[model samples]
Target: MKTAVSIPDRIFEAAEQYARRRGIPRSQVYAEALARFMAEQESDEELTEALNRVCAEVDTSLDEFGRAAARRVVLPASEW
Candidate 1:
């Protein structure tokens, strides 16, 4: 697919230099960067979904003792 997008001059120059150094086409550099970015986004979405599922199943409420213990863990002696 052919698409034109606006990018900063500095970034375009850097990508051009990188492609030239690697003996690859400019399109390949953009394609690989886009593919890697999409993969990272997908992984982040998966991680968020997993965290949501875990949060939904787990009890978040703290009993009095649990709250006290958490406070102790979070607070310094001077603050306590």
Candidate 2:
């Protein structure tokens, strides 16, 4: 499956370097990166939905509730 796509020069350079270092074709590196990116996008959508649900349950806006939730999870000073 051959297709044409345009990417930034810096991204192309990094992909070429990765392919050479791993001894694989540049297409393989691009394919794997695209797959990972798609998966992460899907995960992010799910996370957003879950966060929205939690916010609704608490009857608060996402921004306000997310910060409050973060503040609740206190870690010892040593952990920092």
Candidate 3:
């Protein structure tokens, strides 16, 4: 599919250089980049949905002792 989109000059120059170095068409570079980006976004959405489903199914909460342990583990990290 052919499409027109605006991009920064620096990005365009870098993509042109990359295509020349790899001996691939500019369109192929853009297409591959777009494909990878779309896959990453899809994976993120799937992970979020899975987490939500698990949280909904599991009716649980930390006891005071468990919460204290968690707080101990996290307090040191917050200082950094």
- TM-score for each predicted model, relative to the true structure: 0.79, 0.67, 0.75
RMSD, candidate 2, Å: 7.9
User: Candidate 1's C-alpha lDDT?
Assistant: 0.95
Better of 1 and 3 by TM-score: 1
lDDT of 1 by residue, 1-80 (tens): 99999999999999999999999999999999999999999999999999999989999888999989877876665553
For 1-80, candidate 2 gives per-residue lDDT tens digits of 89999999999999999999999999999899999999999999999999989987995644876877667764332365
Quantify all predictions' global Cα lDDT against the true fold.
0.95, 0.88, 0.95
Per-residue lDDT of 1-80 in model 3, one digit per residue for the tens?
Answer: 89999999999999999999999999999999999999999999999999999999996698998889888997767865
Better of 1 and 2 by lDDT: 1
Q: Which regions of candidate 3 deviate over 4 angstroms?
A: 60-80
Q: What is the clash count of model 3?
A: 0
Q: Which stretches of candidate 2 lie over 4 Å from their true place?
A: 61-80
